[model samples]
Target: MIKGLFETHINVSNYEKSSSFYEKLLNIIPLYEDRVRKSKFYWVGKPGESMLGIRENYPSPLVQRQHFAFRVDVEDIIHANDYLKALGIESTNFYGDSPEELMVFPFMPAVSIYFDDPDGHSIELIAMLNDEPRTELEIMSWKDWNQLHTK
Candidate 1:
């Protein structure tokens, strides 16, 4: 069974800068980094399951509009946003229409703060609230979907 998300990877233009940015934002040392491949991989959230990977690519091409979302501790959200703002990092507000749902950027179910790494790759710092109903996530696997939908 697919237990959980193992990692999320993004191609970057400057490996060192991107690595530093994530390290600073996440407040954890990278589990592994490879200078030879111009890539850096790290683990956050979980000891073995969650990993973040970044690679170097010059003349940064605009990647397709895609984003990876992670549910984070609510307290971390405030600290992360303040840290980003202090460093002059730009982020978009997810919650707009609804005051209760408003976040740093326009999104759904959760309050998300969107920013970029040094390579201009988008990153999101999301505050996963308990109030976000389970129905908000559309499950893919029939087993998981059926289990939750039935509940």
Candidate 2:
């Protein structure tokens, strides 16, 4: 059986631009760079825990966009939108709502923020909460989700 997600790869048009964005946004140092293949790899979450591979796209007209999320601290997820906005990146809720809004997944009772990379791929920052799942609640704004627990 599969154990866990070791690494995920995405094709970027330019290695220099994408790598620089990730470096500045995440402050992650690349672990390896394949000069011949023009691929760069970086550790995510932590070293040896997870990895992200970014490959420079070949000369092709069509592009395939993929979605992925990075597991982060609850506090980080809460402040992600603002943090991203400060970097000139825009974030949205699950419903494409306000950038200041965050999405709460009822099934997992987790919080997340959705954003796009330079290549137009959907990327997310998610944090699993310690609270029990509220499946009946479906999805809601983070504020509403918290209010339910506070009452």
lDDT of every model, 2 decimals: 0.60, 0.82
Tens digits of per-residue lDDT, candidate 2, 105-126, equal 9899788888888888798888
lDDT of 1 by residue, 12-125 (tens): 767887776787765444888788888888877766868888777522544433477666776766566566777877665443222223343112334556676665556776
Q: In candidate 1, which residue pairs clash?
A: 92-104, 92-105, 93-104, 93-105, 93-106, 94-104, 94-105, 94-106, 95-102, 95-103
Model 2 C-alpha RMSD to native = 1.7
Q: In terms of TM-score, how similar is model 2 to the real structure? A: 0.91
> Which residues of candidate 2, in runs, are more than 4 Å off?
58-61
lDDT of 1 at 52: 80
RMSD of each: 8.0, 1.7
Those runs of model 1 whose alpha carbons end farther than 4 Å from true positions after fitting are 58-66, 95-101, 104-108, 132-151
